[model samples]
Target chain A: MLGAMEVVSPTAPPRGARGLHRFANPGRFLRLAGRALPWVSAIGLVLVALGLVWGLFFAPADWQQGDAVRIMYVHVPAAWLASAGYMALACASAVALVWRHPLADLAAVEIAPVGAGFTAICLVTGSLWGKPMWGAFWVWDARLTSVLVLFFLYLGHIALTRAFDSPERGYRAGAILALVGVVNLPIIKFSVDWWNTLHQPASITLTGAPTMYVGMLWPLLFTALGASFIFAALVLARLSAAVMERRIRALLAARAEGT
Target chain B: MTHLAYIVPAYVSALVIPAWLAGEAWLRLRRARARLLALEGGRRR
Candidate 1:
C-alpha cells in the first residue's frame, strides 16, 4: 500500500535527538515552539539590530549615489530571497508530490504568501530606486519584466494551491505548477546580459568581482543572512500553527461525532 | 536636497516591515499555544 503511493515513512527517532519526538506530535510541536520561541525572537532582534545600525549609520556612502545606494542594503537581499524562496517552495512541493511528505505541502502553502510579499517589496523598492537612477518608475527592461513575471508566478502558485475543494488535490496541482515555473528563475537572473535593459547590470554576480566596497559589503551580507534565517523562522512558526489548527479541528470533529 | 532625504524612508521601511511580520507571527504562535493548553487542560479534567 505504501509503495503504490509515495509516502515519507517516519523514521525511528534518533538517539540524542531525545525529547524532540514532541515536535512530531502537534502538542509537542506547540510546546517546543514555546520554548524555542525566545531564541528565534532574540536572534532576529540582534541580527536586525546589528544590520540596521551598520547599514544605516556606520556604512560609508557610495561615491556615485551617496547614501541613496543604501537602498540596495535592503532591496538586493529582498530580491535574492524572493527568487530563492520560490525555488525553495518548488523543491518542497516536488518532494511533497513525489515523496508525499505529510508536512511538505503545508510548508509550501505557508511559504507562498511570504515569498510573494518579499517579491513585491523588491519590485517596489527597485522601482523607487530606479526612478532617480535609471530615469523611470517603470520599465519593460528585460530584468524588470522577468522579475515582474516572477512576482506573478508567485501569485499564481498561491492561488492555485488553495483553489481545490480537496486540499490534497490543490497541493498536487500547485506543486506541479511550481515545478514548471522554476524555468523562469534563470531567465530572471540573466536578463541584463541576455537583452539590453535600463536596469543596471548586477552589482554582484557569480563570475565577477562585486562593485560594492568592503565597508558596504559586510552589513549587506549580514542583512542577507539574517533575512534568510528570519524567513525560515517565520515559515517554521507558521507551519507549527497550521499543525495546531488541524489538531483542534480534529478534536472538534471527534466531539461532534461523540455527541 | 542631497540623498540624505531618501534615507529616512528607506531605513524606516526596512525596519518596520520585517519587524511587523515577525512580531505578528510570534503573537499568533503565542495565542495558539495558550488556546491549546486551555483546551488540553480541560480535556484532562
Candidate 2:
C-alpha cells in the first residue's frame, strides 16, 4: 500500500541521490506538497480544535494554578515546537554545509522565521502564564534566560541569512550561526533542574511515568501533535514558495544572459 | 473564569501566530507560482 502511494504521489522523492535526490528535486517536491497540503491542513485544524476544546473546557484545572493552568494547552506545545524547530534548522544547515544540497539550504533559510515565530509565541505565552503563577510577568531565571537567548539566536539566524546579496553567502553564514546556537537547546532543557529558578522542573520525564494525570496529559499530547502537524504544513508551504522563487530567479538569469 | 485573561491570550497567541505564518506562507507560494508561470509562458512566446 505504501509503495503504491509512493508510485502515485508526486511528492515522493525518486530513488536517487540515496533517496535525498527525490525530495531534492523542487518540481517533485512542489507536486507532492500540493497533494499533501490540504490533508495536513485539515487534520491539523481538526486536532488543534479538539485539543483546545478538551483542554480548555473538559480537562481538570490544576489545584494550584487554577484556570490559569489552561495556558499549558498552548504554551507547552509552542515551547516544544520552538526547540524542535531549531534542531531541525540545525540539521538542515548541516546538510547544506556538508552536502551542498540546495534544497537543504533553502529549508534552513525558510525555517528560521517560522521557528522564530514559534519561539515568540512560547515566550509571550510563558509570560502570561508566569504572571499569574509566578507573581511576575517576566524573570531572568535560567530557563527563561536561555529561552530568551534562543529567541535571539533565531533572530540572528534570520538576519544573517538575509544579510548578503549572494544567497550562498547568506546560507553559509546562517548555517554557522545555527550550528553554534544548538548549545542553547540543552541549556533550555536542563535549566529548571540546574538552577533554583521560579520555573518548574520537567513534568514529563523520559524514564519515569508522566507526573500529569491522563485527563490533562491526553489533551496536552493532542495539542502537541496538532501543533507539530501545523508546523510541518507551514514549513512545506514555505519551502514550496522558496523553491518556486529560486526557479523564477534561475529562469530570469537565463533570459538575461540570452538577451 | 478566574485568570480568564491569561488563558485567552495564551490560546489566542498560539492560534493567531501560526495562522498568520500559514497565511504568509500561502501568499508567498501563490505569488511565486504565478511569477514562475508567467516567466515560463513568456519564454515559450
Candidate 3:
C-alpha cells in the first residue's frame, strides 16, 4: 500500500522514485522538513507574539466581561487547536491504516501529546477566566467537562500506541482508537447548545459573521492561525525524529545479525 | 492587573506549556539526528 518507498537504506543508491512515492522516502522528508523548519518556526512565533500583544493591550475589552475577556486570547485558540488537532490526528490515523503510510503513522504518534498540551491550556485558561466571571475555578459545565474528556482521549491514544511489543501492532491499535475517538469531536462542539449549559454558544460560525467585536476578533484569529502553524512545525520535528529512531533500531539490529 | 492571581497563572500556562512541548520535541529531534549521523558515519568508515 505504501508503494516502493521503503526507508531508503542509508547504504543504498538514491532511486528515481516518482509521484507521491518520491516524497514518502524518509530521506526526502527529512530534507524538506529541515528546509521548512526555520521558516515555519520564525513566522509562527512572530505572529503569535504580535497577536497576543494586540489582544492583551490594544483589543477593546468587553463591556460585559471587562478585562477577564482578555483570557479568551489564549483560551479560545487553545480550544480551537485542541479540537482541530484531534481531527488532524484522526485523519493521520486514517491515512496510516488505509495506505500504511509510514509518515502518517509517525504523525499520528506525535500529534497526541501536543494536542493534549493544547487541551490542558484550554482547561486551565478557561478556569482562570471562570474564577473572575463565574465565581468558581471550575464547574461541571458541558463545554468544560467535554473538553476534559477530550484530554483523556489524547492520553488514551498515547498509552495504547505504546502498549504493544511490536511497533506495527501498536500503531494499528492506536490508529483504531483515534478513529473511534473522533466521534467525541462533534459532541464537544454541540454540547453547549444541546444542554442548558453556562457556557455560551459559539460566537463565530462559518456561515455567519462573528458575534465578537471586530477589534477583539482580529487578534483571536491571528493567534489561532499562528498557533496552528507552530503545531505543524512541532509535529514535523517529531516525525523526523521518529523516522531516525526507526532507522537507528534497524541499524542496530543489522549489526547484531552480522556479528 | 485585575484578578492578578487568575490572569497571571492563565498567561503563564499559555506561555509555559507550549514552550515545554517545543523544547522537548526539539531536544528529541536533535539527539536522534546526532545519533543517526554518528552511526552512519561509523558504517561508511
For every candidate, the chain B TM-score is 0.79, 0.85, 0.84
lDDT of 2 by residue, A105-181 (tens): 99998888899999999999999999989899998999999999999999999999999999899999999999999
Q: State the C-alpha lDDT per candidate.
A: 0.73, 0.86, 0.85
Off by over 4 Å in 3: A1-20
Query: DockQ (C-alpha) of model 2?
Result: 0.62
DockQ-based class of model 2: medium
Q: Write the per-residue lDDT of candidate 3 for residues A69-178, one digit (tens) a residue.
A: 88998999999999999999999999899877768888899999999999999999998998889888888988888899999999999999999999889899999999
Which candidate model has the greater DockQ, 2 or 3? 2
The runs of at least 3 residues in candidate 2 whose Cα sits more than 4 Å from the true structure, single-residue gaps closed, are: A1-16
lDDT of 3 by residue, B1-45 (tens): 356677778989999998888888788777787788788778889
Clashing pairs in 2: A11-A32, A13-A22, A14-A22
Question: Sorted by DockQ, highest first, which candidate order results?
Answer: 2, 3, 1
- Model 1 error, position A209 (Å): 2.9
lDDT of 1 by residue, A1-259 (tens): 0001111112343455433232344444545554565566567556766886898789988877777788887888889999999999998898787767666787888788778877877887787677666667798988888889888988998899889998889989889988998999999888887888887778777888888798998888888877777777777677776766666666677878978
How far in Å is the alpha carbon of A44 misplaced in model 1? 3.0
Candidate 3 local lDDT, residue A227: 91
